[model samples]
Target: MWVLVLFDLPTETRKDRQVATRFRKSLLDDGFSMFQFSIYMRFCASRENADVHARRVKKSLPKHGKVCIMQITDKQFGMIELFHGQKEIEPEKPSQQLELF
Candidate 1:
């Protein structure tokens, strides 16, 4: 299984930099590879391991920060591919449909 973790921190002041640094370091200690800056991570492990690591990462973050974890399996990746292949809808569709009423 692959787990992707996304997080954001409130940047009210310079303090956010320190907190973000600590959070990243904690994730690293927990054996998570950095895929992006507080955006994505890849962890190859079992579901239980992923959950435990995600919780630890969340706990290590600052009080004002936000974190989200998503576990992806092979089937989920296939679904993503299907969704990505869909065409985009025109922006005017909603208004045009409403006017028909």
Candidate 2:
């Protein structure tokens, strides 16, 4: 299985950068690869590896920040790669639609 870990912090201050670096190192030590900024993709051999990595990351993040883990299938990974190859498209509408009677 593949796990995608995304993280967000309050700001990109020096302290935040340090924390992020440490977090990345920790993930690398646990055998995760960087997929994007603040996102890590890992190929886990078993559920135990994923669980351990999750727990370690949860414990390592700052109190003011957040980390999210999503398990992605091989098909999803391929879709992600395909999507990455194309330019981003804007939404059709700029404002929310309203209904009135």
Q: Candidate 2 has which clashing residue pairs, if any?
A: none
lDDT, candidate 2, 1-101, per-residue tens: 56778988666688877877888788888767776778887766556666777777777777677889887654555554223457653322212325354
Tell me the deviation in Å of residue 31 in model 1: 1.5
Please give the TM-score that candidate 2 achieves against the real structure. 0.67
How big is the RMSD of model 1? 14.9
- Evaluated against the true structure, the overall lDDT of model 2 is 0.69
Candidate 2, residue 60: CA error in Å? 1.3
Instruction: Please report how far candidate 2 places residue 87 from its true position, in Å.
Output: 7.5
Q: How close is every model to the real structure, measured as TM-score?
A: 0.62, 0.67
Against the reference, the lDDT scores of all candidates come to 0.64, 0.69
Q: Write the per-residue lDDT of candidate 1 for residues 43-67, one digit (tens) a residue.
A: 4546776677677766776787678
